[model samples]
Target: MSENGGGTARRRRRGSATVAARTGVAPNSGDILWEIFLRLPPQPSSLPRVSLVCKRWRRLAADPEFLIRFRAHHRKAPLLGLFKEYGGWVSFTPVLGAPDRIPRRRFSMRIDYGGGAETHPFHGTLLGCRHGRVLAVDPRRREVLVCDPITGDQRRVALPPEFGTCGGAHGAVLCADGDEGHVHGGCHSSPFKVVLVQISFGPGHPPPFARVYSSETGVWSDPILAAEGSRGYVDLSRPSTLIGNSLYWWLHGSYLCNMEILEFDVGRQSLAVINSLPVGDTVKSKGCIQIIQPEDGRVGFAMLSYPSLEMWDLKDDCGGGVAAWVPRKTMNLDLVPNMRVTEASIVGYAEDDDAILIKFNNNIFIVQLESMQSRKLYDCFVRHQYHPFASFYSSGSAKRKA
Candidate 1:
């Protein structure tokens, strides 16, 4: 991805209406053509077809600004696809087409594991995914693999201080460029932060050892302490969400039965905790959690309650009075008789849009956040999170689909 990162606006193709006016095309102006191209379905497969229409359209289709606008325009039509393990290898499937429709599983692509032709089994679990990229960890190999599933470009980073024989806590967040003191959501280079910690029990807790690695800095920071009683223990199995400058260890329950999200402010190098909705006895054993971003871009919580899914958006009261999560939407599964989700698990969270992927043992469906409507994705067995095609854009490359 070389030709990237100067913060250049090379792909911002604007002024289409003016050009069309000069060409004297009345009824269908260049602006109209441009809008049509911008409105082109964001299926990575359709862009090339639009590009083939003409050189002018090709230039607009490839423009970063246009791509960004297209995403925003269709943000409501979120559900891009699923990244799941198939036959011992991870692959991507675009089960989602346009909004308001549940398309069949038309096709899928095998994502190459760029860690060389490894004959060994990669027992790597997905840590987090965003912007068309994924961060996964192979605990056995003591390393983490960051890859762009769309392009097959990947890199490996070793675990910090090793996960050696101790109860360790770990998670990765696909954060944007937060090094410059602000969240550069689309400043371009897709960077992420990985956290590793030693879990200690009993009194004192010895400050709980921790370390972080940033893709931007390309090095692990000096060990930082997460204080004591931070959350009884960190579940490395669940992925974290990177919102603004904070990296969250989400969905952890406390002794009091309150769901919580531990905030690891990547910029301040500190830790804080936020409370989520309370758990009732009925769904206590049956429920699960997933961290997703809502329409406003704040961290949202999706709690799985057997027959229904509850969503709440977190709000921060800047004046230091009180911050709480307010209930936003609810999705009832009882409406869909075929979706007998006895053991539903959160498969994916599209932070860039309002769509989320939740799956039962064999059935998976994409739920739009706004409408809370669910649609089945045939053959989609939940899979790892991260991506809606937004992360594939880099300064050096374009889409591979035709």
Candidate 2:
């Protein structure tokens, strides 16, 4: 009887060990790796933290398959942060992705003129990011730097004659149109072809003529005259916006409330006047064109109407010309006396994505476009302290820390 009981006890212990091994409680190397890959999605933002949990997780996170999956998931996530300030600039990143969630991973970097007692005049901010590399210009020193935010690797390029200016300059990352002929073969359109455009304003000039830069050829081209007979009267407050290869700027004419849209053909290196928005008496008097991209992916330009916010949509024009001003929606401050839209500007359009971020009264507000629910992201100064800009990049690399 004693021998039988001992044998039974040994059998029960063996069964318990078998169950633990099968369920991964005492996981093997393969089980640990598979588990890490399975936990990658939904919590991609937490990858950086996961890697630090254990040695097995760190190795699994660095796996090629894990990185590919992480990149695919991160591309669709929303990220909002300040990039630069003191140069009157701000940017937004509509889509951000990372493959390796290692320490010191940066999606973007900002270049600004460091303010000091000497107060050196600096050009506007410039961002160069594509194919895992970025370039930025320092206006105070008149230099361009090539940097890898992930590796902390950087190379500085001296500015050519055209890039140097005391007043300031603007820079852009331009991508060439891959579907020039609409070739839709097995060839997936390569989104990597890109160029850079920088415009420098001469010192003490009201309106600055823009200097062009091309990353394809890596040289500074000739100066682009803002418009015929209106060289020094254009509005340099807002940075140029790129739709495809073309760059758009809002040029306010010298005449009272006159405005024209300047479209720069980045590929052809030419410029043309596209269309003009109708400036109402109230908007004309305010001396500003407030363009906002809503969460619905619609681009609306608004101007102060005192009590009412007047907005117009440019998407429905059908290229016939600038569409006639139409009122889509209005926010009335009179109804909510305590709530005010301050430092109000449309950062970008998420388009049916439920959430939209807007800057009001120097504060950043993330509001649901459908539900109208809202939350304050941070303090005004903390939100806009860095010059904010927006860009979208492909996802396929390892996850990296932001």
Candidate 3:
């Protein structure tokens, strides 16, 4: 009886080991592993940590096809932080905490003027951020840089002679590959285009012109001038908004109350001005206006006046032209009894989340328009144009410190 029991116990142990080996090999299968990794949380460190699991895991995490599928599985890229430029030095403020809280220094870039006869007169200006690239202008050098904040990679595009000595140049960087099924935020390896708009105020200078630079073709298109006799200058401090195929910038007219919308149609390669203010001129003059796309996904603007926040969406006529600004919704900040609202100012808008960043009492808070939910992000003492940097960072170029 004792010998039989011993033999039975050995048989059971062999069966358990066989099952363990089968399960282990099954999880490591290409399809199974790929599916498992694709479901990982959409965070900056998600892939990096997975890569550390083993050599095979590392290779799978860095695979190009797998990376594309991983990003597509997660449509919306996570908002990592905000980029603010001061004195030619761009700094990043991390908004998320813990594993996603990228160190501010990781994304900071100090613009080098490269002392020369053609050195830029002023420091670099942070124009905008999109698809994981930050756009900045080297005015003295008469060039623009498309920089990847995550990998510290930069491609310099020399400015056209027509843009030389131009005043207040603002531009945007975007993926040049017009793939309708392509996902943005992770377009680090794709070709890109730089759309630069320069406004020259004095006579004998060309009217406001916008030029497009294509990376694939390695050339700039003919100057697309603004509408004949278009008068106004864009605020270098304000960022550009890209809605659909058009890019919008707030064009400030001669008078304080004169504010207009500057539109650059990427599809037609045309520039025009929309002369209208959704709210009263008082809010515009006070610099409380921000271009936004509400939940309904229409081009709009948000105005903040102390405790009250008003939003409006631009209605487009069937003729494919901007019709009017329709009121959307209003939120009263006074509802939060614990808050002391001394003064409020509009800082920027996060188009991905349909939220607006508001600064009040030296603190910055992101208020979502849909739910009217507000959450304090950072303690900002000074005013800076906050550019939302959202992306699905990969482990291949992971540079964040532990």
Candidate 4:
């Protein structure tokens, strides 16, 4: 019986070799090849080049289930570049090098900032990006454009009439799918929601409100007022930080006013105001403040005071009804080579990457929060809004149907 079993195993091995030579693929190698391809870097060009290897490889690479597995294997999307709006034109600055660096022209969009006589003079604002889509407001057209930087697909959704004359506006784009297990890096085809928060500074205008637009419904919902008509100034210059189902924006304050946080709950479709950070007098002078989500995925606050960065986390109370900010670790960035931290401000935050884009002394630098490593991206003296664009993009993946 042992001799018979040994002969049978040898015959099976020989059979596999014969099949491999005939079809150019080893028996059961497809499963192994699938696993190997799943480990490829989540870059836009990764799968396309893999598809070029051969027809079988191309078939496997284009498999929708394989694409989903590839995205799930690498949970977080690669930070391909940063988007900034300047002179009514939104441009993309690639953060990666060579093969991973997406060209600027591929994602660039020219805002029709009411150049024609019939259109209003209101300029478009590049609000923020999430799940591979960019949200921008074109008030002149009374509509918001949802742009897919990967495929260059743009969907124009008209805003509610009340938001037509808003003093200032800041918006957030997110995938509408509420599945917790759903991977977001490649959500090009997923339904999404656009939350537009209106800012009013003058009298007689309607109080600040938020209106949500759902792609599933193809229309905007009724305006949701902030809790008890909470009158707080939203810092439109800074992008919002999304923690859990809530989106947070830093509220700027005047000399007599204290800064606060604006919270928008996507699930409840409600807006509320959170109290100001208990930064205390340690920060005698306010530098650049940004709302950041820390490594634990909790709501966090970061205040950059020239050389040092102070981090804070929101801790829930015993009953969980109220939350308070707790001081976290502070890192000194003065060790950044060759540049004096004379003028420093955080331009953008890459939530998944755990990094922030800092504008220091007319040079843009990307500083990793955990590693504390820094690298200067470029130099720019002009003022612009930067939104970090991170997504799992593939040129061929978009063209192929799932």
Candidate 5:
């Protein structure tokens, strides 16, 4: 007690010294508080920019906990309306209550490509979306883009040089793991794998060929050549849709006039010809292949037969000797003006949610399956909008489960 107080005092000093020696410094109240803040879930709105603040903050912002919280809050968030004016796309978060209510804020950004005042020569449509990316192609430009709306990240890929001289119009099919299939369905459990199929017209004197691209491998590989014997007169103007790993197109060949479904095996990097829809009398009257996701976690390809919607289960292959075409459900919308089922393209499906989005004559409509009711969402056409496409981002957490 004379030199250094009591034995207890000496032990306390030694304990503090050991902690300082191990950690390189005495723990301060401020340091402990900062650590606690780092472990807490971040605010959703500021997450993207917050990740760029500092290394420590970036890690915290990217934490799975933060994403979960962000997505949970985003689910109830109001829908965002985006439109093009003066040659650029602008986004506005709509007011929840009234359609006439003014938006609280506006986001202005320019898309690099647009049709402008001229009508787009390409007639292809958007097929699928994954990892916040949208895939679109224009036959006129003979170009393809994998784009991210939120980050404005785009990768432009040109068609093969031979595709230019092929004379036949061009079409593209974008495929990715489904939101539910990736999030809930235990399919292939790899997060980095993505399969995209680009079907381009082969040079004159031969059949059309498909180029398959795997995100796992940056290079595109040639798959087995498709039989052009039946696709000589096929129109390339209309885009193809990807259901699962397969791309379907309406082939109007001289030999057989029908919709051709080309299945590209993502794992094998091979191609196989699936069954084709029966040919109808007229070109315009023929049924076009459209992919729709039913709420029950199944992908359905609906072939529009005038007044009726002919649906098929994409997951099941009608046995080799069996008839594949089985009538599932039909909706008669002949009474709706300009709403003929054949003219509208199925843009999105939330089957479990009992809703589907269709694009017809450049207008977007939301329809309820049970009630068979339709409502126009918005008029996306502005200044001859070329190949207008829309895709939503599933939280990265969702892809991780895939």
Candidate 6:
């Protein structure tokens, strides 16, 4: 059993004197005990479990100060796992144990919904992933759930009233709770918010609707229009990409298949369309477009054409706030001889390490940044739905530590 992000907190509320009395130490010695716990292994699988040693330990471990320090110490761990949900089966196969590799357990959501739950591993569509938590819609499509697969904690999203069907609700984003202003820890006790991207009906030119639910308020906000400046529905199937505090939607044109990128400010509850990828003269290039956060912690666009994949970073020109998209990495499939042997497609962007997940025939591979090599993880059959995601534990973790 790993450390509980917050659930393991001992409610005993022992006094400092009582704690010191139990340990046969002076009251002022509690600081020394806390200092010792500060040295606990940074592994998420250890600290919480170790806290159960005693009430005093639990108190020390759950201390916001300790959590902050603990997070700072183990902040450099890379993507520890890749979760895949396909063919009505959703499983998180541990990937962090690779000898020279990427990272988890074979954990699946065992949901218990209102004493009327679905299957052990809920057949659901994974909409978005962040902070080690996933937002998924059940197979029935009746509701959206914010789930922490590791901790088995889930909160059903509050939907907009008379919102009708889930037709236009293509994407869901989970805003986790942590500290006072930000999301930290493992999302065990932090109050969260769920935002649903549900499109509005009618022909006249209606913007996509954003149905938001806040855990603290215990209610869903009325449907609000999203991606205001752009028109036409987004490719509902494609998961929305989050960069900084804004979520982006890759909107496609109706007839000619035009592509547009729109940014939605989560805090402001507003949307603005941004520049699209520079396909240059090859606008009709047969490939897929995905928004990725590259190694430099900036939003990037990755376009896959045949055996070649090119990534472009969204950068600002020298002038004040002049937005520009710049090419960053280009990997030719020729390096991987087998890539030419069959059909391949870009799966999505791995935001944690700036790699691209690609599907070649029956297997899934991550295009590596170093050496222009590739790492293969599993064999994803045609019927399975694959969603590769990792928490914000990269170089960003160090700076984001609360």
Backbone clashes, each candidate: 2, 28, 2, 0, 4, 7
How much lDDT does each candidate structure score? 0.56, 0.44, 0.77, 0.74, 0.43, 0.59
Q: Across residues 1-402, which tens digit of lDDT does each residue of candidate 6 receive?
A: 345633444333345445543343433444687656656654444455666689887776666545555555545334556666666455665444423232233245667755763545577666766666777776374777787654556777644555444555565555545444343434455677777665543356566667667788888776666545454456544667777777776766553245567666778887565645576543333235677765453466777765666778777663697777777887776534644446466665555455667777777777765456678766776623345545423221222211
| Regions of candidate 1 where Cα sits further than 4 Å from its true position | 1-32, 54-56, 63-79, 85-93, 97-121, 162-167, 178-192, 201-204, 207-210, 251-259, 275-277, 292-300, 311-331, 338-348, 379-402
Scanning candidate 4 in windows of ten residues, the lowest lDDT window is 113-122
Q: Positional deviation of 120 in candidate 5, in angstroms? A: 17
Q: What lDDT is reached at residue 145 by model 3?
A: 79
Query: For residues 1-402, what per-residue lDDT tens digits would candidate 4 score against the true structure?
Result: 999999999999878755543333434555688768878888778888988989999998886666766777788988888888777667788978777777776666643334542422224777888888888877567778898867656688877777763346788999987765578868887999999887654345555679888999998888888754334566655788888889888765553136677789899888876665676554543346677775553578777876788888877762556776777888988646675556677788887766778888788888888888988877889756688888888776443212
* TM match of model 6 to true structure: 0.70
Model 5 error, position 366 (Å): 2.3
Give the TM-scores of the predictions, in the order they appear. 0.69, 0.56, 0.82, 0.82, 0.52, 0.70
Residue 338 lDDT in candidate 4: 75
Against the hidden true structure, what lDDT does model 2 obtain?
Answer: 0.44
Best by lDDT, which number?
3
Model 4 lDDT at residue 291: 78
Candidate 2 residues 36-96, lDDT tens each? 5544543335554566889977776655444434444334332323343345332333222
User: Residue 395 lDDT in model 3?
Assistant: 54
Higher-lDDT candidate of 2 and 3: 3
Between the candidate structures 1 and 2, which one is better when assessed by TM-score?
1
Model 3 lDDT at residue 380: 81
Which residue pairs show backbone clashes in model 6? 3-48, 3-49, 86-385, 94-104, 95-103, 95-104, 96-103
Error of 4 at 366 (Å): 1.9
lDDT of 1: 0.56
For candidate 5, write residues 1-402 as lDDT tens digits. Answer: 565667787788767755643343433444453344434332223444555678876775565443333333333222333222222222332312343322323122223465353321223333333333445443456655554444444465675665562245333434344453133111123223333333443245544455655454656666456554333334433334444454445444444444565555554556555555543442243223454543332245555443555555543546775545444676764425755343555544432234455556566665666677877766644222222223222233222210
Rank the models by lDDT, top first.
3, 4, 6, 1, 2, 5
Candidate 3 error regions (>4 Å): 1-33, 54-56, 110-123, 200-207, 254-256, 281-286, 294-298, 318-322, 334-336, 399-402
